[model samples]
Target chain A: MGDIEITELRKLTEFIKQEFDYDFKNYAMSSFRRRIQRVLDLYKMDSVDELIRLLAKQEFFFEEFISEVTVNVTEMFRDPTFWRVLREHIIPNILLNHNKISIWHAGCSSGEEIISMMIMLDEMGVADKAKIVATDVDKAIIERAKKATYPLKNMEVNRKNYLRYQGKYTLERYYKESGSEAIINPSLLENVSYRKHDLVQGSVFSKFDLVLCRNVMIYFNQTLQNDVLHKLHESLFKYGYLVIGSKESLIWCDIAHKFIVVNNEEKIYKKIKD
Target chain B: MPKFELSTKYKAIVIGGSAGSFQPITQILAALPKEFPVPLFLCLHRLKHVRHGFVEALSIKSNKDVIEPADKESIRKDKVYLAPANYHMALELGHFISLSTEELINNSRPSIDITFESAAYAYRDKVIGILLSGANKDGAAGMEAIHAKNGMTIVQDPSKSVINAMPNAALARTKVDYILSVEEIIEFLLELDKKYRI
Candidate 1:
C-alpha cells in the first residue's frame, strides 16, 4: 500500500525469480500486489523482511504462493456464446480441413472449459476424431481436471448449457450422480490429454486446429500478452481458429496481423496465411 | 421449506451486469414501454475501486428514471435503482432497497448472487429471477434459490448470451422455466406482466 511496500515487493520478485525461475515480474500490478499482500497476510508478518526470511528458509510457501497467486476463478461453459461461435463457424471449418483434428485449450483452469469442449465435440459426433491436449500453468488444477468430478448441484446447469449448445442427449444419462456430485462420462476424455504448460515459455506442440486461451492473459502485461500471442500463433495450424476472452485483444501484440478476425466482436479469430 | 409456484407480483425489477453484459442490459431496457410501471434495480459489475455512473448512462438511453439507490431508500415504480460501488444491494421488505459494504461474495461486491438471493428471500413467491451474461458461476445458485421459492426463473440462452458463463451456469443448476435470448427475454417479461395484471 506504500512505496516501502513496493520496494520490498521488488526484492521479493527478484528472490522468487532467481530461486524458483517462475516469473511474476511482468504480471499486472494488481495481481502482483494481491498475491504479495496475501503472502504477507498469511505469515502474519508486519514487514517484507520477515516474509523474505520465511521464503528463504521454507520451501513449501513458494509452491503454495504460486498456486494461490495464479489460480483464477473459472467454470465450465465459461462463455456460452464463444463456444456457440466455435460450434457454428469454427468446427465446420476444422472438419473441412482434416478428419483427424487436434485442438488445444491452453491455460485451461480446473479443466471445466476443456470438458465443455469435449462435451461439445461428443455432441457433434466428432469425439472419436478430435483429440484435445488441455494444458494449464497450475499442476494442481490440472490434476483436478483429470479427475473430472463436479458438484452435483451444477449438473442441472451443465445440462442446460449442453442443450443450449445443441447437445441432443439428456445430461443425466452422461453421468450418474452420487449423493452431491456427478462423475463426468469417461468417454468424454477418450481422445483428451492433460498437460502442464506455460504460454510464456512457448509450446512444444504445434499445428492445432483450434486454440482457446480465454481470460488468462488479462493478468499479464502487454509484452507478455504479445509473447503469449506469438506462441499461440506458432502453435496454430494454417487457417486454424483462435479464441480469446471478450475484453482481451491482439491489437498491440506483435503478431496481431497474423490472425484476422472471424467474429471480431466475439473475440474469435482465424490464423491468416503467412 | 414450503414450495409454491412463483410468479411476479410486486412489479419491481432489479438487474445487475458486468463485463460483456452491456449489450444485453441495453437491449432489454430499450424494449420496455415508456410508461413501465415496475421499479428496476441494476448492479453493473466493475472493479470495486471506482463508481460507474451507470444511472446517467442508462437514463440517457431510455425514458425510465435510472438513479443510484440512496441508503435506505424506498423503492418506487417506474424508477430504477443501480447499486453503487463497494456495496451489496438488497431488497428490504418487498418495496425498498438496502446497501451494505460487506466483504465480497463470489468475488464481487454488487454480486448478482447476493442481490438475487435477497430478492428471493424478501419477495418469496413474487420474485422473478433472470440471469443474463457473466464469466463466473455467481448467479447460478442464487437463481436456483429463487426457483426453489417458487419464483419464476429465466436464463439467457448461453448460445445467445454475450458472455455465456453466468447465464449458462444458471441454466445448468436449475430447471429454469424460460430460456430466452436478450430480445425474447424483454418480450417475455412484458407478456408476463400483461398476463398477470388481470
Candidate 2:
C-alpha cells in the first residue's frame, strides 16, 4: 500500500481499538487488506477513511466489521484423517491417564468441531466425562454456533466427512432436519460451553487435556502466532495434545522444541515438557 | 531462441494458472535448471481436500525441488513452491510465505490475483508475474498490480494457450512484457538463467 493508504489503515485500526477495543494491528496485512476491501465494498465506501467515519458513526457497523474480519470457514470433522487419529489413538491415550477430559476448541467458529468432538465422546460412551470449551473472537458467530442449526445443504459434506472418519453411528442421529436447516441434537452440547474469546488478546482460561486450534493461526503473523502458541502451550496440561490445521506446521515456532510430534501429517503434537 | 539479458534485480518469479495449466507449467519447470537463481511460486487451482500427489507429479519433470509450502515457510531460491489448495498464499514482509484460509476471491482459493498482488507489494520491482492458461479471469487484476508496481508481467499468448480465458483477461487489463507460447516460455526462462545465473 501507498503511504496514504497505510496511514488510513492505521487510523482505521486505531479507531476500532478506541471504540470496539479489538486489536487488529497484529493481523497479517495482505489478508487483512483483502477483508477490509470486502467491508469497504459492502458499505459502498470509497476508502478506509470513509469506512472509519461510518464505523465511528454507526454502532451496528462494528458488529458487521467483526464478522467480516473473523473468518468462520469451518466444517464438521474437517480433515478425516485428523479426526480418525484423534478417535483411534489420541483420545484413547488421554483416557488412560485421566477418566475425565477437558478440550478447548480455540477459534471454534460455528462450533462444528465441538459438535464433532461431542459426537466422538458420545460414541465412546464418555459424554458425561468430557467438557468442551468452544470459543471464537466474534460474539455473533458464537451466538450462531450456540443455535447448533446449520443449513441442510451442508449436511452432505458433514456426513461424508463423518463416514470417512469411520463413525460408529450414522451422522443423521445427531441432527433433525426442519425446513432447510438441520437442528443439531441439543444433547450434544450438554458438556460444551460457548464463549466469545479473542485468541490474540484473551488469557488462557483453563488447563486442557487437548487443545484443537485448527486453521486459525494461519491468519496471524509470526509474532502473533508465536505469542498464541505460547499461550496454548501454557494452557495445556503436561503431555497435553495440541492439534493445529493440517496445512500448518509448528516447526518454525520457538515452542516447537517443547512439543513432540504425535502425528506429523495431521499436525498433532504432544506437549513433552513444561 | 534469442539471447535475452534478464535484470539481475528480479528476486522472485510467480506463476498463476487454473484449468489446462498443468502441462504448460510442467514444460516450463522442466526446462529450468537446478540452480535457477530465483524461487518460483506456483498458484494453480486444484481440489482442496485432495492435496497430495500434485507436488510429486510436478516434480517428476522438473529439475528443481517441487513442494507445497507450509504456512509461514521461508522462500528459498531454486525451489518450486506450490501454494496449498483451499488457502490464499501471500508473500510476507520477511521473504516468507504466509497461508490464509480466508474467504475465496473470484470463487477460487489460491486465487491468482491475491498472490500476485501480495508478491507485487512485497517484492515491488523485484518480482516477475506470469499468468498462464486457465478457464477464468482470476489472474487479471494480479497482473495489473504487478505492472503497476514496476515489476515485470508476462501472459501466455491467448491463441497458443490451451485455455485462453486467463491470458486474454490479463492482456485486457495490462500491457504485459511478454506474450510467449508454452515452448517459448521455457526458452525464455532458460535464457534468463543463461544471462543471470552466477
Candidate 3:
C-alpha cells in the first residue's frame, strides 16, 4: 500500500477504537494491513474509508471484519515432539506438584490443541482433576470450536500427528465419524470452557499450572509481545510452565530473566519466581 | 553499463529468490562490504523440514554475519538475516522480523512476497527489494508492492538467471527499476556501499 492508504488505515484503526471499542493499534502493522486489504477486497470497497463507512452503517459488516482479521489456522497435535515432551515430562511434573491442574490455552483457535491436551490428560487418568480454559479474540471461532465437529478430510493429518505423538489409542477412539464430519466425544470437553478473550487487551482472568500460547505472539509487534509475555508471566502460578511456538523465542523480552528455559528446543520455559 | 548513484534514503535491503537462487545470492553477499550500511533480509526457498547448516554455508561465503533469525529478533545492520524454512517471515515496523506459520502464499513457506510486501510497508521508500533467480512467481506481486510504495525494485536479468520464470514473472507485473545481471547486481551493491557508507 502507498502512504495515503497507510494513513487512511491508521485513521480507520482509530475510528474502530473510538466507535466500536476494539483497539488494534498494537497489532503488527504488516499483518494488519494485509488483513485490512483482504477485507477491502472481499467487500469490493475502494478503500479503508469505504470500509470504515460500511462498518459504521452495518452491524454484520463488523462481524465479517473480525472473522477475517482473526486467523484460525491450526491442527491437532502439531509438532508431535512438543506434545511428547508435554506428556512425558511437563504433565507428570505438574502432577507431582499439584493435586489438581489448571491449564489455559491462550489464543486457542479452533480448539485443536486444547482437545489434544484433554485427550492426553484423559489417558493419564487426570482428566477429572484438570480444569481447562481455551480462549481467542474472535467469538465466531470459539463457537466453531465449541461444536467440536471437524471435517472428515482433516482426520488423516490429525491422525498422522497423533500417531507420531505415540498416542496409545487410535485418534478415532475420541471421535465418532459419520459422513463428512467427525464430532469429538462430548465427554472430553467436560471440564473445558471456551471463551472470547483478547490477549492484547484482556486482563488476566486467573492463574494456571500451564499456559500454552504457541504461535499467537508472532502476530504482535515486539512491544505488544513484551506486554503479553508480562501478562502471561503474571497469569502463571509460581513454577508454572509456558510453552510457545517452536519458532518463537522469549529471549528478546524483558521478562527473559524471570523465566528459566525448561526445554530450549521446544521453546518451553518455567516461571522462576513470584 | 552506465553507473547510477545509490540513494542514501534506503534503510534496508531485502533479497528474495527460490530454486537455483543460492549461487547469485552468495555472489551478491560476498561482494557487499562487511560494513554495508543497510541491514539485509534474505528470503530464499528451501526444504521445509531440514533446518540445519544453511546459515553456516551462507556465512562461509558472505563477509557479513549470516544467521537464521529467531522469531521476533530485532533487525540489525551489517548482518544477513536468512528466513528460516517452513515459516512466512515478515518485518514489523521496520525494527524486527516476525515469523508466521500461516498458510503458505504461492505454495511456499518463507514466502518472498510476504517478506517483500512487509518490508515495503514498513520502510516505504526507504527499502530496496531485489527479486533474484527462482522457479516460481512468488515475488512478482511483492515487487509490485515495493514499486507501489516507491521502494526501489530490481530483478535479475532473466537470461542470467538459472531459473528465469521468477524474474520473467516479476518483469511482467511491474516496471522494475533495474534488470541487472548477477555480476552487475554485485557491482551495484558495491557502488551502493561506496556511495552510502559513512
Best by DockQ: 2
Candidate 1 lDDT for residue A29 = 47
How far off is residue A271 in model 1, in Å?
0.9
Q: Candidate 1, DockQ to 2 decimals?
A: 0.03
User: Could you give candidate 3's per-residue lDDT for residues A1-274 as a string of tens digits?
Assistant: 4333667878988998998788888777677777787777787877788888899999777877988886677789988888999999999999997899999999998889988999998998889989899999888889888989999988887898899889989999999988999999988999998889989889999999999999899887788999999999999999999999888988879989999999987899999987
- Taking all chains together, each candidate's TM-score versus the true structure is 0.60, 0.94, 0.89
List the pairs of residues colliding in candidate 1. Answer: A80-B164, A156-B172, A157-B171, A157-B172, A157-B173, A158-B172, B6-B150, B14-B41, B15-B41
Candidate structures ordered by TM-score, highest first: 2, 3, 1
What are the per-residue Cα lDDT tens digits for candidate 1 across B1-198?
Answer: 512333446555546566688888877777777666567777667654344456566777776777766434567876767776655677755366655443467788778876887677667666777777788888787788788877778787888877888877887788788787887778776775565565
Give, for candidate 1 chain B, the lowest lDDT window spanning 10 residues.
Answer: B1-10
Top model number, TM-score = 2
* TM (chain A) per model: 0.90, 0.96, 0.96
Error of 1 at B171 (Å): 37
| Poorest 10 consecutive residues by lDDT, candidate 2 chain A | A1-10
Tell me the TM-score for chain B of model 2. Answer: 0.96
Q: What lDDT score goes with residue A51 in model 3?
A: 88
